[model samples]
Target: LRIRGGAVEAYDGAGGRRHWTHTRAGRRPLAVRPAPGHAFALWSDGLVTDTARTTGRTVHWHRAVPGLSRWLAAGGPGRAAGVLQALDRAARMLAVVTPQRIAAYRTRDGDLRWVLPAEPGCAFDARRTARTGGALLVAQPCGAGASWTAELVAVDDLGRIVPDRTPLRNGPPGDHARARKVVAGDR
Candidate 1:
């Protein structure tokens, strides 16, 4: 099977005969992943497209946060929610990361699970992101001028910011002692 110009085509390998074609609507797909039961998860911008391999049927899943339409319309942090940063299939969550916030959705049906917002004037560093035991760990760089520090923050599967009991960093104790204090205070 191959996708071209928003169309999915399948040709018989033996005789090179055209088997079927399925046309999809919306922007081009950014990434495609195998889902349960011979289905595929295709994401583009903020839309989730699930296509069946056998029949080539399509289902478009729109990911959105409830009661945040006005905020999103006003150009709030949720405005950039479409840009996907990471996907955790085992956790059954589709994570979207921006400098301002992180949102997770159910990969099966594209339901909004949780949204983690950054502190005021602080931003999350997506480059150093890591996941452990279903938790998404992100480095948030926050502080005043000349005294800035990258603090480690962990978002649990339930979207709560919880302290990680296990050591995420391997550096000296002093390196993360102060960072732990900041993260602990949030709890």
Candidate 2:
């Protein structure tokens, strides 16, 4: 609830949950809703979903994707083996900043559609993506405070990278992303 005059008196649930809940400091929220879905949240920090409200389902250990092993091994055999091992999984995207560490999804239907590698200025805290046509926009956050760099990648039919990396600056709605011919498809 807002200040009628000075003091704060929230509505039903909000008033009872003051101790455990907090709001954004300087910014105003446009909307609020409960979290959704049946699959449980896999994060330790807790993730909220709609449809279900407070919590959802737990991501079982078997479903979890393990990190790369032997990725840091020395010699040609190490790196070669590392890449080969990772490619065995059915993935749609193989985003990587380096060969050893990065996160992307592997589709149930083996399709290496896209890869969003971490950019130069990015701190590797958020998702980085390079796409081809269908939902191929990768938004990379700029430094803290304000600004964002996004690239709308274009992929080929074989799901191989076509390079053509595009550079973008801050823009309006829908156009918050931008890209032009840049890098050649390395994959």
Candidate 3:
């Protein structure tokens, strides 16, 4: 799919035109990223998708945490920094990081599954660091002044944060380095 003039256009394998959806006015889409077998287009106010759009799929814009909305309203940097597919593709989950938090939603229906608080003053690095069992490791940079720290978070197939996992500290911010790099082949 390609976005042009605030619209999403889908093309066939032979490059033939398929269909298109014009994004809602005043909703500036910052990026378009691949989902499991489809794709998602991220807008400043919300998301617009050709592969997945249904009734009752609207996100409650008012429900977003105050800090996040404030950051977005302020046109904070790295607003579109992180977007990824959940390691468990069968779950059809999409993870997106705003300035203050990481949110997971059902890609097919746009149901919010979970939202994890992210480190303040940091941008979530979208790279996934392999898989551990049914969980995936996520990292972000938490810097104070000239010093930097890496905070690690883990989420399961259900999009819930896995607690008790120690945060990686004093590491190179946003490096792909991890304790293990086990690929979760074909669940």
Best by TM-score: 3
lDDT for 83 in candidate 3 is 49
- Residues 2-103, model 1: lDDT tens digits: 555565565566897766665545654433444342233333334444455456655545553333333334553324333344344443456655567777
Clash totals in order: 0, 23, 0
Residue-by-residue lDDT tens digits, candidate 3, 83-149: 4445464545566655456777655556565677765666655543446777777666676563432
Worst ten-residue run, lDDT, model 3?
54-63
Candidate 2 per-residue lDDT over residues 127-176, each given as its tens digit: 34444434333344546654543332322322324444344321223543
Global lDDT of model 1: 0.52
> How well does candidate 1 score on lDDT at residue 35?
38
By lDDT, the candidates rank as: 3, 1, 2
lDDT of each: 0.52, 0.28, 0.53
Better of 1 and 3 by TM-score: 3
| TM-score to native of every candidate shown | 0.50, 0.25, 0.57
Cα TM-score of candidate 3: 0.57
Which residue pairs collide, candidate 3? none
Q: What is the overall TM-score of model 2 with all chains considered together?
A: 0.25
